[model samples]
Target: MRFLSLAGWLTVVVATAAPPSVELQLQDEAKQLVVRVEGQPAMAYQFGDEFALPHFWPLRSPSEKLLTVQRPDPYPHHRSLWIADKVQMGDGPVVDFYHSWKNLRRPSKPADGFRHFIRHQRFSEMKTEGATALIEIELQWIVDDNRPLLDEHRKLRLVALGNGAYFFDLTWNLQPHEGDVKFLSDGVHYAWPYVRMHPQFSGEQGGVLTNDEGRRGQAGTNDQTARWIDYSNTVAGETEGLALFVYPDDTPPQWLTREYGTFGPRRAEKWSGTKFTLRAGESLHGRVGVFVHRGDAKSGRVAEHYRQYVEDKL
Candidate 1:
């Protein structure tokens, strides 16, 4: 092969030096951490002193379409993207961190005992670059008396995957601060690492839900186990959607899906008297992959992206 001449090489280099299509820019505010892409608002991590638990709200696509919902009238406790569940504190009483937000003021039953809180402690590390942003944060699951029941180290990574798509990865390391802790389900649904889709993407709005097991619709896919689930909708004459992927492991997680647009993997249910135990000083780690694409599942090639994610290609 003949090598390029000096003049030709210089021309090639200059032509290839275009700016990146997307850039991950972060703005740290007093109450929220806002992330922008190409100078456009992408999403915000709401961990202010007023929030009961941290959440990512108003996640937007590269086309600037909102993908998540928060504090809808029907479900006041359903934040956009969050990790939460009813928990048991070893020998102590059971607590409901998922619904016990002080700002929520959800009526509580005395028999329900004291509600708990998940407070954002601090950010341990954060880094952002041309197309990716990674953040590590510490959180405390505490009771009314300020007794910390569990400590959580959560790592979130976001990457601009070109073609109006995005990749989001979440890793959680949880350990009991005082004693053993158990994630107890509410029996009706398991609520952990959840995403509430926007109202415009609801099934009533002509949205479609598909899973790896070839299941479709919210009824057949609910409480089912699948490697990935996609919820797609047509908005303004364009098809776009979000997908959830459960990494390959010995035991795949049982997922919770809804037509109203809430989905996530859940811990075992209380009706089954099941609990995921985390011993003191021992951390329980879990990981998941999320893809936000510009088209429906098939059109977006969600399976292919999921394969790349599993292989760590992206």
Candidate 2:
């Protein structure tokens, strides 16, 4: 009897310490990939053709609170979390995939006569290992009707951290498929990947934005170069936040911060506001980490996580 009781107790302890299970579900009809932790959806990747481009929406905190807002008022083009920019293929007109709606013939019908768009071709890979899930997808930068300007390979990895926090790792590889492609995005209008927090988590609603340098709020942090940035707030008596970390690149990055609810790292000065060409067959690469955690930046150990991310520890 004593031995049996001891074994039962050990089983309970091991179960309590076990890491949460992560799962990836592909909903083809919905055109979305839902990532669930322990069977509950933590976030989703929306790639439906109904929109100007693909984006991630409803990024939820550990407490299941929505941390991001999609197409909010004033800036309806700002998808919750996404990447886009202006580009020109050969001598063709510059198409602003970042503000892609301009190429649509009808705002209500995105599939009608869109001239230029980013189309998700297929998912090359999707799998889960232990508490981590990964997705690899192929996409194309399309111009005219069916001409391909660039081929994009994107990978996303989600690691389930205990206590409901998580790490979202993103890597992008863009190769010019046709001729030389010129990136014509200006410094003031772009971010490699933007995060637009929900109104409840915006500075207007008592949230705080802080960078690695201890700069707080939009006025102090806007356009500043930082290794990481965090946004947090207390809502419904619970504190939670999100942080973004940019990997090292040739040109140090600048960021765009807003008090109303937007923040992201911009391309380096050498490329922003100037033409950077990727000759045919050449590729441009980028990587970033999105850390969603409980509590404020300090309490959440945003800096430590960022360091770990840089060292590939997480």
Candidate 3:
């Protein structure tokens, strides 16, 4: 009996000392890559060809509460979390990959009529190191079925933050595959990557929007520049939120925030409402961090995390 009790105690001790872990699972049939932290589903990357473009949906809070909404009304093009922009390849017609469906001949049948899209060609890497999972993928900005306009290399790293929270880092590198690719996005209608929160966590539903400089709400933060922004709220008696952080060197001159649940950093002033071009060998690169935590910005130490992000600590 004494020996059995000692063995039971050792088992409990080992379990308590175990570190958090992250896992990536490819669900081919679903055309999604599911990310799990400590064995719980946290988010998914949807890349089915049937989709107008690749996007991440069902981004959940630490407690597994859905924090994002896909295809919300008023602007169905606003995917939960995605990257998009308008571009013209060489002298070709301007392609609105942001409002991608507009480039489709038959909007309802995406697989049949997509004239321009950000296509996920393949996942080049998927591996776990310590408590973090890394994913690297190849994508193409294609036009007219098979004409590739840009080649993209996307990298994502997810780290398991203890107590149910997590940190995600994303990098995008785009190189013109053909001739010059001109970015012709408007200042008002775009984000480097947008996050649309679930209705329950929207500002209209009691969520709070905060920026690094201490601004709050759409009126205060919209069209304003910031190093980082956070949206948080208490839903079902639990407080949780997510923060988007821009790299110090790549901080956009302005950000777009909406009380209806949409928020993100816009491109720099030089590129907004104007044209920026990348030559055939030139690449446009950007990086951002997402911190999903179990409390509001204050309690979640959003500022601290942002600092770590800039210092390569987070």
What is the number of backbone collisions in each predicted candidate, taken in the order shown? 0, 0, 0
What TM-score fits each model?
0.85, 0.93, 0.93
Encode model 3's per-residue lDDT on 1-314: one tens digit a residue: 12234645552223344688898889999999999988899999999987778989889999999999888986888889998888898789899888877888776866676777889999999999878999999999888888998999999999998877999999999999979999988778788888899988899999999999899999999999999999999999999999999997754558889999999987666666577898889988878899999889999999999999999987
RMSD of 1: 4.7
Off by over 4 Å in 1: 1-29, 101-115, 267-273
lDDT of 1 at 188: 61
Q: Provide the global lDDT of candidate 2 against the true structure.
A: 0.87
Model 2 sits at a Cα RMSD from the real structure of 2.8
In candidate 1, list every pair of residues with a backbone clash: none
Better of 1 and 3 by TM-score: 3
Q: Name the 10 consecutive residues with the lowest summed lDDT in model 3.
A: 8-17
Give the Cα lDDT of each candidate.
0.76, 0.87, 0.88
lDDT of 1 by residue, 1-314 (tens): 23345755542223333333444344456667776655667777888655667888878866888888888656777889988767777567677766654323344533333346688888898788788888888998877557888889999888877655678788888888877788776756654578899988867678888988778888878877778899889988888998988778645567778888888875423222265676778876767888888888898899999899889887
Candidate 2 residue spans exceeding 4 A from truth: 1-15, 107-113
Off by over 4 Å in 3: 1-17, 107-111, 250-252
